[model samples]
Target: MPDPTATQALGRFVAGSDWRDIPAALRHEAKRSILNHVGCALGTARDPAVQAALRVMRGLGGAPAATVFGQGARLDPMGAAFVNAVASNLLDYDDTHLDTVIHPAAPVAPPLFALAEQRGLPGAAVLHAFLLGGEVACRIGNAVSPGHYARGWHITSTCGAFGAAAGCAGLLGLSAEQVAHAIGIASSEAAGTVENLPNAAKNVSVGNAARHGILAAMFAAEGYDAAPAAIEGPLGWARAAGDAADVAAITEGLGTRWEIGRNTYKPYPAGIVFHAVIDACLELRARLDAPPEAIAAVTVAGDALLLARGDRAVRNARDSRVSIHHSAALGLLRGRAGVADFEQPAVDDPALAGFRAKVTAALDAALPRGAARVTVRLANGREEETTVLTPRGSEARPLTDAELEAKYHENAALGGCADRAAAQIAAIWGLEEAADLGHLTALLA
Candidate 1:
């Protein structure tokens, strides 16, 4: 169990770079990711869950260090990061990286926004830090591969710890050595379990990752000590999580190969893995005009992994995300799935129950990750079938820029900032000239 050479190389690379050194493509991707995060955050701003968390945060009020997006209240960096990160993930609509299966924005954006406000930093700097963080998270995710996620650990919390540290380290202007220490410190603090799937606690994992990362960076900046080989050490992250660690993937194109380009946006509000099935169901619904009662049975065949890897025993809405039966049922009954699809009334609706009872899912041992085959049996003894090779909004069939913007606006409106957030976000993109992050922060308020 010697140190992993590849993980060590990645640490060195992460520890060495400055924001100015990131490439142009990476920068552009970073901006898009930022926009995506802001949109999702605004969408969840007014959610009861987010509001409840905000109220608790407000009561524990500390120094006014940074602003909470859409809430307009300032909190200490750690608290602000926690609340904002939770809000971004409240609706499960944040951007994700396929390689690591990590929700990139959930952990990256909160720290960047909080630090920007604390340091009076401009939008450009915040955006750069975000890109760097996403790159680090995705690379680490790739290094670990399907192993990390399959091990019952949530990627957004595990790989994301390092991402949060990188963003905070960049903003704090820590030296490479200090950044390395921060990475090491953050590694030890990482903890999340997939067992929390579809729970309000699921979103808490993301917020905790962001908050802990900030703490790790702050500690390193103040002369904290951590094992230099934390990532690559015999018992480090790779050995513990990755099936067969690929360190080269971690450091191969540092500062050049942007992981941000590989990031995917969610078109539907369910798990990324279930998007194709939902798409297939929606397409079938469009072609057939019948109510849920007219359906005899609905069958979905896709990556067996969905049925195999997913937790089928759903007790609540959050649990519904990982349940193929639940997602497919919602798709057939309502012709769509969203945050509202998993609500109590929706989940308990008699029509939805009838549809759910008719829905049968099996893993297509042959289908690929982004593909699915769905069959609907009509009460009239007629049957329809459709196969989706790739869901919309995936890199295989990306959403148009206009579609992306529309998604942002739609989510922003949900978070209670639909009217002005988009325009303000545009201004923030030109943040190199802005004096403070207040103008943008106020939009969330």
Candidate 2:
């Protein structure tokens, strides 16, 4: 028999998946992904970008059917999804699939929650939808990666639409044919570029991914249709955006193996490539005989992708999050690499600014994408160096459930929702058994 088309195969997989068929371990991982996603969104709910999105959404009003997290107001499902997607991704601190560098949860989870709340769906349904959507995004990321990202497509924002559509379609109980149409529709909506990574424009693209996914699924549910090969045909998304899509990448072990299983959460609010740089610098800091201020020079070496993504001038907080020099300084000088370390104030701090100048980056092709080597030369005639291949929060060195909870609490405090953190935590932890999302959505607001 001939192989099925990419979109059709994906549609069928999503439509056919059962919550009971998913292993307990995968479900737990999905819960972790959702938990981390919510914390990241809540962490930046009051951020300038999020505020701007919320204000715009309020002006362009729709039915108040879903919660806009961290704010008291509710908006239509699309509006809520848009605002929440921006908030979760604005910090660049969300979960990552290392191979594709796609922040899967940011674009996928918002729509799932928004639709669940709007439809009064069970939390288990939301969780199941999130898992399938996140998996679809990562798999599509795999199909177009390396070249696609190298060609400047923002993998998360571009592939996220497909995940969003597939997940939302499942929640809507669309048939396989409808799900395929949803995926095909999402192909037209998929957009966002790596060139816009250092500014708020990037967040807008993520917002669009969430909003458009819902739009695609909604349209498909209404009997909208698209060409069957909308994703992999010569004129389709894969070839149109990049060199080509790897059919094997999208279809191999489609449902049995999970890409969400490979997901990694962030410990620092910086690009995942820079985590190893931070880890190495933190280690070198411990071994240095002199104070960080006494250090005359710092060197960071990593793969070409790291230098490509992080070797840049930091003009603001957004730039700082992707700046290798800034990450090195935070670990060496501040001894911590938290959200505050990447804020505008931190960017403008004279001490950090001066220290950033002391740091330099170079390429070592031998090093892995998330790996880094750091060398610090001090004025006291002492030098210290270290290498970190698997930084904290990586799948190999996963954050403990307790550590993840601490992160959630810290994010809640940062978003001024500390008073509600405990209840939010309880709701998320008990999500699978909940009747509906009302309790969780209320706490998010």
**Leading candidate by lDDT:** 2
Error of 1 at 331 (Å): 2.8
What does candidate 2's lDDT look like per residue over 160-194, in tens digits? 99999999999999999999999999999999988
lDDT of 1 by residue, 177-241 (tens): 77778888888888788777667777678888998889998998999967766776788766766
Report residue 117 deviation for candidate 1 (angstroms).
0.8
Pairs with backbone N, CA or C atoms under 3 Å apart (clashes), candidate 1: 42-415, 43-415, 70-444, 198-318, 304-363
Q: What clash count does candidate 1 reach? A: 5
TM-scores vs. true structure, each candidate? 0.92, 0.98
Which parts of model 1 are misplaced by more than 4 Å? 1-8, 15-23, 59-61, 242-244, 289-291, 308-314, 432-435
